[model samples]
Target: MYRKKSKAFYERMLKKYPDVMSIPQMSKACDVSSKTGYKLVREGRIDSLKIGRNLFVPKEYLISYLLIRDENNVR
Candidate 1:
């Protein structure tokens, strides 16, 4: 059986590495497309810190948001 990652799993990763997360990393972690992630950042659904032309999202916040949204799915 395939096991999906939990919020705690991501929390641990964040604790281990506080550095900025790249778009590909975020996409894999949140199981979203890079485009979607960018859209979320633009819409303020997800928080991001920009450095130069790059953007980074806090792992904790991203994981939490994904968990909450998954749990609240209307369908």
Candidate 2:
């Protein structure tokens, strides 16, 4: 049930973004400052992949974070 919504949401996201995104791209997609995006990673609110000097955010992680925030009513 919810999985279908998640998949559908991800499909829509794919139209606007890549499967894996950099911090800046994630920040832009989430409508937050890049600093906040980095903070989310640091605080473990968001999962990330660190490769050398770069950070990558998988689109699934974005959906998870959004769903959590929605469930908790967090801003």
- The model with the greatest lDDT is 2
* Candidate 2 structure quality by residue, lDDT tens digits, 1-75: 233245466458656899899999999998999999999999999999999999999998887887787666677
lDDT of each: 0.71, 0.84
Q: What tens-digit string does per-residue lDDT give for candidate 1 at 1-70? A: 4445577766775665555577667766656798977888889877788889998887766776766665
- Residue 36 miss distance in model 1 (angstroms): 1.1
lDDT of 1 at 53: 95
Give the Å shift of residue 60 in candidate 1. Answer: 1.4
- In candidate 2, stretches whose alpha carbon ends up further than 4 angstroms from where it belongs are 1-7, 10-14
**Candidate 1: stretches off by over 4 Å:** 1-6, 9-19
